[model samples]
Target: MHNAKPLPTYLVQRFQGWKATSYAENSAWYRRLASEGQHPRAMIISCCDSRVHVTSIFGADTGEFFIHRNIANLVPPYKPDGQQHGTSAAVEYAVTALKVAHVIVMGHSSCGGVKGCLDMCSGNAPQLEEKSSFVGRWMDILRPGYDRVVERKPDDMARALEKESVLVSLENLMTFPFVRAAVESQDLSIHGLWHDIGSGSLECYDPKANGYVVV
Candidate 1:
């Protein structure tokens, strides 16, 4: 605790600015949200990359989306092993507790996590191959996806694997019993999306086409 310091001057200044402007103008709205609890319509599982702004891309407001950010926006298959599964825990809370109508797995271009996986797979990143690497263990969840896309043309390999991360997550989410039940009953729907940050383009998975179509 001794190592914990006060907020940086820049962050403090930014917070003060927010309090004076955004918070001042929407004090009542903020209070209402605090009292009522959140009732978001969708759950978005996306990469934690600073460049990927899920809320801004969708123009979402406070409490509008139950968001979970991870290395590559992966959802591991249902295991119920009584282990510490942060991503699965968030999924359970969003699906069973919050009853979000839709669950979205969004991947993005030039994802560092995806690139790390590619490097690890190609034997270029030995550090991630070590036993104690937290990121290595987590990125293992995307190994299947990387393997599936490794045989593709070299030029398309990165982009293909990026999209595969989204697809892999959507598939793993279905492994959850509750999620399957909800989807079967039409209570919940799942979506897979790949976003191009530079161009702000989004491509969605189309089962019929067996590929991502720009949206």
Candidate 2:
């Protein structure tokens, strides 16, 4: 195997400081967690964007959330076709193995992945349409969501589609038999959320309201 370069000095120093401070203060708790393994209560599927801090937003402690991040925070419909599927694998593990009580799909405003899907669907981003484009193929999950929001004004379409991504993921999550069974059995619940980065606002999907409401 090829030898990899060392970590950046700044990151190393920051980790050292955290270990000396935060980790030191909670060493017993950390040790207990290490010995018992994790038992997170929720599974949060969120965008890969650096600005959306899942744990910080919920004030979650370590081992409190089983988190997964991907472009656009989209979950494709369940397909057991003997192919490689990372998101589906994560979902299966979270529901079946981890037995998380809640599965939350969170989207964000001004998401580049959402914008790319909008552009690609609008015929403005031909590069993303290429067969070799992983992002484009992965974003195919959001096309139905775009169709649902296409009637909105041009300026509002992007944000609408962003919220739609959360709805789409929540819907797709149910397509998995294990997830559906868990939800039906009342062992698990699903939620959709959208975060406005600039405004520091959060909105949750309300089935009764048929749209997102401020949280």
Candidate 3:
């Protein structure tokens, strides 16, 4: 309570504007949503980068996507030791409770988290090696990806690692028992995607081709 404060003036103004316009026009829709509750068909696990606008990228409306964002859009391997696992909790709720049909792991170009992982793995970013850094620990989920791409040419390393993040997360998502069960029963499907921020281009991992295909 001591740290709580009133909303900033600009945000308050923006909220007021939305309430007077979008909310006013969609009052019934909003009410219906409240009564019906959210039943999003797909769950999107994406990066925390603000530049990678998840909604606008897919032209999604409110309540259409159950989104869980983390550093580099990484999902840690299933570790159910009763720890406070934010990403895993979101996945569990989406698959088990919401019964989402699809889980998409999305990675974007020029991701700072990916670059940090690259630096950390290369022994260039010493600060991220410390135990106290939450970011460092979180980025550890991408270490396997780094190992896979460590030999790539310097010009292509960043993008390769970025795409690898999606692949790694997709692999790790299966480690969760609920997620695995859902996939096994054909109740859930998982996918991986990489996006070019500047070009607005998308690539989907094709299992048959065993590589990414432009989408």
In model 1, the runs with Cα more than 4 Å from the true position are none
Could you give the C-alpha RMSD of every candidate to the true structure, in order shown?
A: 1.0, 1.1, 1.1
In TM-score terms, candidate 2 sits at: 0.97
Runs in model 3 deviating more than 4 A are 152-154
Candidate 1 backbone collisions, by pair = none
Error of 1 at 133 (Å): 0.7
Kindly list the per-residue Cα lDDT of model 2 for residues 70-104, writing each as its tens digit.
Answer: 99999999999999999999999999999999999
lDDT of 1 at 108: 96
Quickly count the clashes in candidate 1. 0
TM-score of each: 0.97, 0.97, 0.97
| Residue-level lDDT tens digits of model 1 in 43-154 | 9999999999999999999989999999988999999998899999999999999999999999999999999998998899999999999999888998999888976655
**Deviation in Å, model 3, residue 95 alpha carbon:** 0.2
Sliding window of 10 residues with minimal summed lDDT for model 3? 147-156
lDDT score, candidate 1, position 72:
87
lDDT against the true structure, each candidate: 0.94, 0.95, 0.94
Model 3 pairs in collision: none
